[model samples]
Every structure is written in C-alpha cells, then in structure tokens.
Target: SQLSFINVQNRGNFRWPYDGLYQDEDGTLSGVVGGIVLSPDGLWSTSTTCTQTPNFLNAKTCPSSVGRWVRYAFNNANLAPNGEALFIYDTSNHYTIVLNLKKRLTHPDGYMMDLLTRQSYLFQFNGANSSVNLSYTGVVYDLVPGDYLIIRHNIDYIPDRVYTTSSSILAASSNTPLTAT
Candidate 1:
C-alpha cells in the first residue's frame, strides 16, 4: 500500500501532534492572523502588537499610546509551544484553543465564542461573567478576552515533521473535548 503522509507516524507509534505555527511565515494559525490580543485595560486587537487604543473611559487614547492587549493564541510549537498551544501547566495534552499567558487572573472573553464564533473577540457574550480561564479552574479559563484561534483541520494530511512547512490542528479536533466551560 502507498502512504499519503510518509512521516505521519513516529517510531513510538503515535501520530505526531499538529503544529499551528507552520501556517505562515510569521507563525500564526490558519486564516487567523496575529491571534487576537487583549489590552491591559480591556480592549481587543487583531494582533499581539497593539495598533488600537483601549480607552475604557471618555479618555479617548491614541491607538498606539493607549493600553494594549495581553495577547493570546492556540500555540504551534517552539522550545515547548510558548504562545501557540494550550495545556495543563506543561502537559503534552494540548487543548484546541488556549491563552498565551499563564498563571494570571486575566482571561479571554466568554465561552460562547469557542463554540459559536470559533473566535474569542468576534462575539460579545451576555452578563459580566463572560470570562474564561486558560487553566483548568472554575469559571477561570486559560484564555483571555483577546485570545485568538480558528479550528482548521487542513494539517490532517500532514505526513511528517515538516516543521518548516506543516501545521497542527490547534486542539480543535473532535477527538478531544475542546471547551472552556
């Protein structure tokens, strides 16, 4: 038989997990440029590097002069998936979508975005309890309001560890429970 992805499997007999950073030259998820960002105050940006100002008050601040989003992503790969993957304090089981920051009380928007919008900053949820914990805590979620990610399964055809040319599923696969509620 002929194998489509020659290097799909490893000697350990486990399918190599996907890598999201392989999506582009700048190392972001597919269709999701820069991954959403959260300002120190409470504003969202398209990229980690803030271009918009977070003027929570009548304080109209300059885009660059104002506060910036903390930033977040689903994690791709690096020394250990620094800003790409989500997980339980350094575990191998990476979640589909997780925050780039860790151990902080700050969190992503709401849980509805994970299922309905597939993007955090896309939709605003009802109530003041729209926070998500990046960690496995109570209402506390691993992601913040600006966390960004798109459930793309194109890398399912990945044949090997083409780190420079391949990407992973960002834990959005149906196999594991991708949720923050």
Candidate 2:
C-alpha cells in the first residue's frame, strides 16, 4: 500500500496567527499586523448555562460563558493586514500574533475587520456584567456599525523573539492550544 500526505487547508476565513510586518506590493514595510492585546480587566461570569471553551477546541461551541470581549478596529483601506494607521511597534520589526483565550475581566462583544483581506472576525464575551463600551472599545458587532477588524499594536521596543505561526488542527492532528501572550 502506498501512503500519501494530504495538504490540509483552513475551513473558514480564519486568519493565520503571526506577529510581523506586512509589506506592500512594492515590498515596502507596511508595518505590523494582527496584534491583539487581551486586557485582564472585568471578570468572567459563573453561569451554569455558560461554559468557556478552551482555545484548543476551536470548533466546539459553548454556552457563551466566556465573559467580556475586546475589540481593535482598523481602517478599510486597500492596504496590508498591518498597514498604516494600525499597530506599528518597536524598531526590531518583529511581532507575534496571538489569540489568548482565558477567564479574564469584562469585555464587550465586538468584531475586528481586516482591511487588507476585507475579512471580519466576530468575538463575544459572556460576562455577568459585560457591556459594550462603544467609545473606548470600538464598535460592537450587534450594532453592525461597519465592516472592520482591530489588531492593536503598541510597543516601544521589539522583543528578542516574535511568534509568527503555530500548529493548527489542520497541520497537527492533535489539539494544539492557540492563545495570545
């Protein structure tokens, strides 16, 4: 019997996790992209009807126990993922794109729009006191304000090592946990 290797592809429009600079068509430094910073602000609710799904369980659905969400919005310009008016931190020219999922403070259920790819990411935070802060936390998903995603990058200096990619379910059969730092 002959064994063959299959090239697995992503099912949905999920963004590849990587913290780096996006370049323009002319190969110009387009700045950093896909940088999420989860704040330990608010608190996770203790609702029986809700359960938090581990970051490893990417496909599993939960009862909406993950309370609070944070949103970072970017312009819908014909630019790269981390184009201008977005996250541009440090002189090292390196960053890590992470999706940290854990029990944390109150965040608003929000959305992020990728201007380059014209893709939007929806996120929800199931908290007992979770409320959307339109002014400070950007626009809410339910409001349908517009189409966009937020990748915030704020740093003075780049770290020694920037995380680019991780083992996804497609790449690795095992359930690999993908979280933000």
Best by lDDT: 1
Residue 97 C-alpha lDDT in model 1: 33
The Cα RMSD of model 1 versus the native structure comes to 21.8
- Candidates in order, TM-scores: namely 0.19, 0.19
After aligning candidate 2 to the native by TM-score, how far in Å is the CA of 27 from where it should be? 48
Go through the candidates in order and give each one's C-alpha lDDT.
Answer: 0.25, 0.25
lDDT of 1 by residue, 111-163 (tens): 11122122332321122122331222122123346443333322223323221
Model 2, residue 122: C-alpha shift (Å): 18
The residue ranges of model 1 lying beyond 4 angstroms of the native Cα positions read 1-99, 106-150, 158-181
Backbone-clash count (model 2)? 21
